[model samples]
Every structure is written in structure tokens, then in C-alpha cells.
Target: MDIRLNQLTMQFEEMTAVDRMTTTINNGELVSLLGPSGCGKSTTLMLLSGLYKPTSGEIFFGDKNVTRLDAEKRKIGMVFQNYALYPHLSVLKNIMFPLRMQKVPKKEARERAIEMAALVRIDHLLKRKPAQLSGGQQQRVAIARALVKKPKLLLLDEPLSNLDARLRLEMREEIRRIQQEVGITAVFVTHDQEEALSISDRVMLMNAGSIQQDSTPQQMYKKPVNEFVASFLGNPPINLMTVERMEARQYKLENSAQMVLLPERLNHERVRVGVRPEDLYLTDKDSGLLSGKVLHIETIGRDTMIRLKIGNTSVRALVDPKHQLQTGDICTLGADRDNIHYFDCDTGERVNVEKEAQGDADTADVEEYA
Candidate 1:
């Protein structure tokens, strides 16, 4: 089932939680509503589930308008962030509870419940209550309960937030697998960018009660629509340097300590250059694009993150763990020209320098093929 929200708005006395949001989610697609807290993601989910009627606008389940639908009538399976499970009921009974509520026969409900329990790999714990199960197991039970109903749409509201970091990773994969296996149209709401990026088929990034960008995870990260989208998607975040345009292709840092030649067209006298942490590579101090003193070092598994102080600005670079570096060590950093971003200083919007370069690359490839 495909879901469509047209100009969906939710007003709260003096404030608007969701502001003229319009988007389409394809059938059987696991779309994630990703943003910071109070960004209207959860509110949108509620509206879609028919818990709150939109102040204005229409909603459609496929081609049928469901704007006036009620929660109980939507036939939607919802999983909350808290994993709301009945502590008194055994896993089997808890999974069957939804079916029982619909007046399903006892034998049929039990059989379906067992099938769901096995689907989530929690069949062995059918006899255990919520209090006796581990956090991950309990979460699976909650998921099984939601799925046993076989609703056309599945809604998850930060369902993995309660789990540990490791468990969160495990459950995300489990959720993806289950969603695919069931072929149910799923909408997952999460404030964690990594969670959304890792699990969703596409991400609808929201902020300040508005949809910022709706695209695939790779596109969201590689080609963010604005400064906020660029800065919000990455783990360590993209490093931004304020630069004053010196000429058509030249720019100087805010501290006036270094000048750079971008070789890209620009229409403004001031711009901000965005470089992902991974794009900043270690190089000789005299030959690199940026140079600074290493202020901090963090080694996690295969990659090392180094925090460097460049003039008055702080920049972080992700480098190989094998390359040894310590605090107070002077290091030089260079960015991949193809990966660098140019944003309008006044508007905080990407300038598309990278895309232009990509176009030129494509043109070259086509010419060579010809």
C-alpha cells in the first residue's frame, strides 16, 4: 500500500507542528521519517495512523482518500518507541492478543501467533513474560504482535531507541528483514540519522516542522539539499569553513590565514566550503589544502578521527588507524576535490559545484565512448 500526505498541517494553538508537508511513499517501501526531536515526524506518523486528523490537507492510502479515517479503522499495525507489551501476558498470549481482540478463533489465533513468534525468532520464548525476556527479545515480541494482525501498513516510532547500541544494530537488521519478508509498506520514524540511513529504502528528512529533503539514503548523504541536511546526516558531521571570495575562483579563510583556489564558478563574494570528515586526507603540511595542529585523536576499530585546530576554526578528519598521530602534532589535510561542497554563505544552500564537476566527468566519459 502506498501512502500520500498532501499539504498535511498540524497546528497547536500558536505553533504549527507539521507545516504544509507533501510527499508520496511508494508501495512496500520502508520509508523513514528522520529528523531531530519535535520535528513533527512522530506527529506525521500519528496523523497517518489516523490518531490525529490533519488541520488541513488530504491523506490517501493508494487512491482512496482516508483523511477522515479513525485509528481503529485504518487497519494499520503500529509499534511504539517504548515497546508497549503486556508484562503479565506470556509472549504467545501477547502476540495473540491482537488477533483475539478481532474475535479470531482461539485455535487460529494461537497458530498465527506461533507463526509470528517464529518469524521474529522469539518462538522459544513464547512461554516467557515481558519481564523475563531480554530487551531485544521483548522488542521482537512487540514486533510480532504488531505483525500478527497482517495490516496493510506498518508504522514504527523510534522502536529501537530503548535497546542498547549493539542491540539497536541487531534489531535494525531484523526489522529490515521482516519488512522485506512480509512485503508490507512500512514507515519508520527515527531521530537517529544512522538508524534511518541504515534501515530505510528512502529517507524523508525533516526539520523545523518542514520536509527538508526526501531521497534515497545515498543521495541524502552525497547530495544534501541544504546546509542543515549536509551537516545533519553524517556521524562526525561535515567540516564547514567560512571563506570570503577573493576573486572568481579564489577564496580566503575567515582568519585570513590561508587562501584556496576552487576552480569552480561562484556568483557570490562569500561562501562556505563543506568537506566530510572522510574526505579530509592526511598529507604533507606544505602541500595540503588545509593545515593545523592535531588537538585530539580517537581510535575506533579500523578508522581514527583526528580533531585539528586550523587558525581559529576546528576541523575533524577521518584517517586510517594505522597512521599514528598524537595531540599537539602538526598535520596537513587535503580534501577530495570531487567530494567538496560549496554553499551560499547568506542562504546556507549548496552551490552545486560538485554536481557541475560530475557533469563534466560524465561528458568526458561519453565523448571517449563516442
Candidate 2:
């Protein structure tokens, strides 16, 4: 079931919830619509499910246009944030509800429901009421119900949000496995960056009613389309430093002595230098691009999170726990030439590395670090 949204726009009064969004969700691939709250991810999902008709544009489930289809007419199985199970009905009956409504014979519906329950690993819990099951179990029941009718497409709205940390981890794996086993085209909406990265085959990052970037989780993190995409996807966040080009291959932090030998050629005189926290390491002042005083430290597992104050700006880096450092101690940070990212100051677009004699600037001259 390949889903396509062709210039889909959903406007309500003065607000446009889904701006002319056009993209295709490939058959049997699970993609996640990821963004912050009010970014219109949920609204886009609604448009796809036929819950809201677009103000313009078209939607297709395979080659068939479903732009005017009613919600019930579209074969979309939706698993909501809340389980949305019946309190009085047992799991078996709840899972059979959809098939029953379609006038499926009682015997066939019962068998289908039982098979779905087994698929989601909840077959034994079929006799239990919704209130009798744990949060994870209830979620499994919801997933089973959605699949029992053999929906061509499945939409999960923050399916694991209500679970505990451990349960969330467990279900993330389960969802991916079950989705593969069912071989259905699936789309899930979530604000959790890590969750989207781990679970989906691809992620469509949304912002202000438009798709920002659509790519694999690895590419989205390694090579973000823009600064916002880079910042939004990281946990501690990528460190941003304002820099100005001094000359060829020479860039300096704005109004500071922190100089760097940028590996890429820049068309703009002013640009932003982005370096991930994990890419930096502690080094002597002579070999470092920037120097600062240690302001804060936190130990997360074996990795140590260190915040440094450089002039008026604060920079953060993650290091090994073996490096003993106290507050107020002077420190310097160094990054590999390939790890640094450069973006245009005004447009906020990445510098085109392919346009230049790449790596000519990376040949480290000792004086450049001074």
C-alpha cells in the first residue's frame, strides 16, 4: 500500500495546518512524521487518514485518488495515543469490533481476532478486560485490534508514550518487528527524536505546516538540511558558534581569538560553525581551536558531559570519564576537520563542499591553530 500526498493543504480559518505537502510513503515501509508540538505532524496524519479534507491538492492510496473519501471508507487503521479500548468488552471482542461492524461472520471474525492477538503476543490476554491489563498489554491490544481487520495502512499516534521508560524501549522494538511481520504501509506521529530515529525506516521532520526534511534517520542526523533540523534532532543539541571568514581556509569566532582552519570553501564571509558535542575532545591549548574555563560537569554512564565558558558564550563537550577536571579549570577543545559543519550566515544553508577543492584546507598548518 503506497500512500501519496499530492500538494495536500488543510486550512482552518486563518491557520494552515498542513501546507501543500507532497510526498510518497513507499509500500511496506514505516515512516515517522516527527516534529515538535503544533508543528502539524498530527494534522498531516489526519489529512492522510481522511479525517480532514484538504483545502486543496489530492491524496492517493496507490494509483487511486482518495481525496474525497470518508474516514470509514479509507482502509486506515489508527492506533491512538490513548488505547481507545472498550472498558466492558474483553480483549477478543474488542479486537473483533472492526470485523464485526463490516458484517464479518462471528466465526471468521473470532478466528481473525485470535490470530491478530497472537501476532502482537497478546493471545493469552484475550479473556481479560481493558482495566485488567497493564499499560504495555493494553497498547498491544490496541495494535491487535487495528490489525485484525487487515487494514492496508496503519497509523500509530505516539503508541508508546504512555508506557514507562523500560516499556517504551520494549515496545519500540516490538513495533518495528510486528510492522515487518505484518508487511503493511505504516506512518507514526511522534515528537520523540530518538524514538523516531530508532523505529522508522525514514523520518519526515515537520515544522510550521511544512515538511522540513525527509530522509533516513542516520542522514538526517549526520547531514541535516538546515540548522533547525540539526538542532531539533540531537539530544544535548549541536553546539553552534558564530564565525567570520578571515581569509582563505581561515575562519574566526566573531569578536574572539578562537580561529579554525575550515576544510570547506565558503561563499559567504560570515557563517555558523556547528560541531557535535561528541566530536570534540580535550587537548592542549596550542592544539585547540578554542579555549575556555570548565563551568559544569555531569556523568552520564561512561561519558562525561562538560560545559565550558568561552568569553561570553558557553560551549559544551562530551569526554571520557578518565579526564579529571574541576570547575574553574581551564580547558581547550579540538575537533576533526571533517566533523565541523559550516552554514551560510544569512540563508542558513550548508556550504557546498563539492564546489571547492575539498580537503586542501584540512592539511593542518601548526600556525593556523595559534
Candidate 3:
């Protein structure tokens, strides 16, 4: 089902939990609500699932107004971090519970429960109780139960969080596959950026009761709307450097005596440059735009994370594991002009060099990363 939140707001005492949030989620699209704790992501999910009534505004499920609807009457299925399955009930019985609550015929509910169990690949474990299953197995059963009702919408609240790292990956793939096969409108809530990026059709990044950015995972990572979104979405995060324009096409570090020639297209007089760790290439000498001393190196199988100190600023760069580098080594970091991100230091807004030069600085800032 297509879901829309129109000017939604939720308040507790004097604090706003969700502030005038508005967004439309199309049918069959798996959208993720991603952010840190206390960011209102979970609150938004509860509102959509009709578990919490919004302090103001309206919610629509297709053409029906569901803002005041009861949780069970919303035709929404929910799976929580704990799985919430009845320990005494068999997998098949747990899957059939929702159907039975709606007064589905006994024989038909059983058939549908079996079908859903098979869909989530838990049919063979149908007779097992929640206590007899592994974390992943129990989660699969929960998914099966949610799907058994053929709900118009499915809400997942950090469903894979309880599993170990490997199981989290495995279940993420399973969830994506099941969502595709069933084609249900899904809203997945998670604080893990990697998990959301890996499985969501679109991601909604939230902060302090407001939506920060909403876009494809690739876009959100590459072209963040502001410093907060940029720094929050990436592993090792984006490298930030304070800079001042020395002259036309020339810029210098704000805290250092070092200066470098800038690309002709860049026109920001005073700004901060943000470069992804992957975008930086390390060199032996001061031949690049920035020079630093390597402070630490972390080897993680396929990739190496190198930490360097430039003046007083510390930056991390992701390099190949094969690169020979050690602590205390001096290195130069360079980024391709196309990969460099410019943000106004004072406003924390991205600087659009192309638009600034064309005298049209009012264009909407690009927020998604590629």
C-alpha cells in the first residue's frame, strides 16, 4: 500500500519527537528509517504502524485516512528486535495467530501459515517452538508470521539486530528476497547505515525529530545535504579540512602554512572540503594537496584504514591492504577534483561552485552520494 505522512508531528510534554515530518512511500518500496538513537526514527515507525497517535497531522494508506486508526485495524504487520514470538507456541501456530485473530477459517489459516513458513524457508521448523530455534531461525519465524496475514504494510524495527555479524548479513538477504517476492510496502527501522544501505530501496535519514535526507543509499552516501548527513552516513566517515582561498584558484589550510592550487571550477573563498576515505590516494612525498604523518594503520582483510594527522586535523584514508605503510611515515593525500566536496564552513551547507560561478547560487544542493 502507498503510505503518506502529511505534516506529521508528535510531541511529548514540551519536546517534539517528530516535527512536521512529511514523506510519501510508494507501494512495494522497501524504505528504511535510519538514524542514531533519539532521532525519532522509531517514533515515526510507530506512528505509521498506528501504534502511536500523531499529536498533529494526517496519515493515509492509499485513499483511506488512517491517522486515528487502531494499531490492529491498520492492516499492518510488525516485527520487533526481540522477534516477540510466543515461546510456548509452535512456529506454525505462531504464524497462524494473526490470521486466527482476524477470524480466518481454521483450515484456510493453516494453509496460509504453511505457505508463509515455506516462503521464509522455515517450513521444516514449523513444529519447533521459539525456544528450540536459533536467533536467525526465530527471526525467520517472526517474518513468516508477519507475512501470514498478508498485511498491506510490514514494519520491521531492527529485526536483524539480535543476530551475530554473519547472521545479520544472511538474514538481511533473506528479508530483501522475501520483500521482493511478496511485494509488500515495507518500512524498516535501523540505526546501522550499512544495513540500511545494503537492503533499502530508499533511505530516510533522520535527526532530532526531523528528516535530514531522503534518497537512494548511493546518493545519500555520496552527496549528503550537509555536514551532519555527510559525517553520519559513511564508514570511517568523510575527511573534513578547514580551508581559505589564498587567491583565484588557490587555497590554503586555515591552520597550516601549506597552500595548493584549486581547480578552476571551484570558487568558494572560505569553505570546508570533505573527501571520502576511498577518494584519497596516499603518496610518499608532499606532492599532493595535503601532507600528513601517518599515525595508525588498521588492516581488515581486504582493505586497510590509514589514519594521518595534518597540522592539528586528523583524517582517515581507506587504502588497499597491499599498500606498504607504517606509523610515523609522512604521506601526501590527493583527491580528484570531481570527488572533492565543498561546504560553507559557517552555514554547514554545500558550496555549489558551478552554480556560484554561473550566478545562480539558489539551486537546491545535491544531497545523495553515488
- In TM-score terms, candidate 3 sits at 0.92
lDDT of 1: 0.87
How far in Å is the alpha carbon of 1 misplaced in model 2? Answer: 2.2
Worst 10 residues of 3 by lDDT: 361-370
Each candidate's number of clashing pairs is 0, 0, 8
Tens digits of lDDT, candidate 3, 1-370: 6899999999989989999999999999999999999999999999998999999999999999999999999988999999999999999999999999999999999999999999999889989989999999999999989888889999999999999999999999999999999999999999999999989888999999989988878777766777888889887789888888988878888777768667777677788888999898876454587777899999866889999887778889988777788899887888887577888899887676554332323224422321
Give the best candidate by TM-score: 2
Worst lDDT 10-window in candidate 1: 360-369
Native-referenced Cα lDDT, model 2: 0.86
Clashing pairs in 1: none
What TM-score would each prediction reach against the true structure?
0.92, 0.93, 0.92
lDDT of each: 0.87, 0.86, 0.87
Could you give candidate 1's per-residue lDDT for residues 197-288 as a string of tens digits? 88887889999889998877777777777899999989788999888878877778888577776756566688888999998899886557
Model 1: residues with Cα > 4 Å off, grouped in runs: 285-287, 322-326, 354-370
